[model samples]
Target: MNLASISTKQYVEQRDKGYWIAGTRISLDSVVYSFLNGESPEGIVQNFPLLSLEQVYGVITFYLANQELVDAYLKEDEAEFRRLQEACREKNPLLYQKLKAAQAQKNSAA
Candidate 1:
């Protein structure tokens, strides 16, 4: 199937609406987020081996099919990611700071 277009039916779920990302261990939000961030479908599949090519295509299709839904999912996921990042920072002060600083420096240079 073409990876460029997908549908909601392809956006499978498990446990609950938000329990699994597109019917795989990967969450719907995370997959969409990575794809928006320029991750290739194959890259996403590799990162999430639990996902079949169809699942990846499905999520990609879902996002393409439902812009509003995908956007909302991405927003919620951003907050969740920030929460985790902050928690990690608190848990590992030095490492967190080092990585943050490095990332910031890299961005600034760019």
Candidate 2:
């Protein structure tokens, strides 16, 4: 067996400004979050039909092998998301308020 092939096989790549499943645009964060939330590999595959069972398992293995680095990256990504959300809310207070009210109504109905 080519140790190089086994050692160099990468499940994720950083490009287009984010980490994605090597050749697909599906973000690693999506799989990680779903897995963290108790979703099975099959469930994750269903949620992201573009991904295969192998790809999901590969990404999960990658995450497990690099949990500390991946966790820090996740934290940074979440902070950026919150910052962008706040900026959007400030830019469109009316739309934000309308969405918030709609969400509340939906929740009450549920």
Candidate 3:
């Protein structure tokens, strides 16, 4: 019997929303971050029900094999997110302040 083999390239995709699991909306960052935080492939699959254990493992392998490149992409992505967040805050200071206060209140309650 013959089994099909899949390429790592087929597991991850670079889209406008950054690196994502090829056919799904789940981000590679989500899996990578969870793995880094000590979650097992099984655990990751649990967190992202859309992903299978095979997909999670494949993503992890891809991340390990291209760690440096992936890390750089993640850093750049984070910077872009921060930039957009700041722009939004600047454009809507009142809304931002309200959100910030709400967050603080929530945190304090915790």
Candidate 4:
């Protein structure tokens, strides 16, 4: 088989936004996070039914083989998420403030 086709057979694909398993919308970040949080490969498949056990195991193998690189990418992704969240909050300060107040009130009632 050709190299490109062979590579596509891998569990993961590098997408425009981030890495995802082939044939699914599930992100590598989601899988890695669950795995790191003590979820087994089987458990991951249970959590994301779109994925197969074989795919989950392959992703775990990939993560173990490239831990440092994947960790760095995850960190950058988190930073970008935080930046976007902050921007959204800034754009809707009143809405956020009201939400925060409601949450606080709910917490206090609890």
Candidate 5:
């Protein structure tokens, strides 16, 4: 198949929460984040064993080809994540505090 034909068959899907790779639970954001963090495609595949190198490369290509749009989407997703985290904390202040304390203790121990 030609390049155009192959690309037209999207490897990513848009969901209510965020973009995911078409056939897997892996998030497109995670792939892009790893790539932006200077991980090689091989490294990304290593980190996410479920993903093939081709899928990782496709995600990177999509991000590179649409950097502005993808960045905006990522920013919005992050904001939503922070909002949900705050809401969860508000809903369970004591639990959140305890979890934070435990995490801090673990970090100190490490």
Candidate 6:
């Protein structure tokens, strides 16, 4: 919110009305995850061609500033995705159990 405090000197206001890494093609969540996993900013930018150096840095800045909230959102999304998957499984437990058992058997055999 404070332009003076923003070090990036340039950023795009995101869909969340939050500023993110300046030149990235995807959300900062993906960038943050990549960065946390040891991906370089340039590597991320190169991997996502549409993203620019500025965007990558901006995303890093944003991620640093609001990491907790972003992490929470990611966690929430994961939980929701899992919940949906569980619902699908519940809808057909016999089939799901059979598939799971088969996968386990295959895994054990391998």
Q: For each candidate in the order shown, give its overall lDDT on alpha carbons.
A: 0.76, 0.94, 0.92, 0.92, 0.90, 0.76
Clashing pairs in 5: none
lDDT of the structure predicted as candidate 6: 0.76
Better of 1 and 5 by lDDT: 5
TM-score of each: 0.55, 0.89, 0.87, 0.84, 0.86, 0.63
Q: Give me the runs in candidate 3 sitting further than 4 Å from their true place.
A: 1-9
Error of 3 at 71 (Å): 0.3
Query: What lDDT tens digits, residue by residue, belong to model 1 across residues 1-110?
Result: 87768654545564554635644466776777789899999999898888877878877876788788768766786799899988998899999889989999999999
Instruction: List the candidate 6 regions with Cα displacement exceeding 4 Å.
Output: 1-25, 92-110
Which candidate has the highest lDDT of all? 2
Better of 1 and 4 by TM-score: 4
Candidate 3 residues 1-110, lDDT tens each?
33456433489988985899999999999999999999999999889999989899889999999999999988998999999999999999999999999999999999
Model 5 spans with C-alpha error above 4 angstroms: 1-8
Task: Give me the displacement of residue 41 in model 2, in angstroms.
Answer: 1.0
lDDT of 1: 0.76
| Model 5 quality (TM-score) | 0.86
Give me the candidate number with maximum TM-score: 2
Task: Tell me which of candidates 2 and 6 scores higher on TM-score.
Answer: 2
Residue lDDT tens for model 5, 1-110? 67766645577888876799888999998999999999999999999999988889888888888899899999998899899999999999999999999999999999
Report the C-alpha lDDT of model 2 over 42-86, residue by residue, as the tens digit.
Answer: 999999999999999999999999999999999999999999999
Candidate 5 contains a number of clashing pairs equal to: 0
* lDDT tens per residue, model 4, 1-110: 67666544588889996899877888999999999999999999999998999999999999999999899999999999999989989999999999999999999999
lDDT of 2 at 80: 97
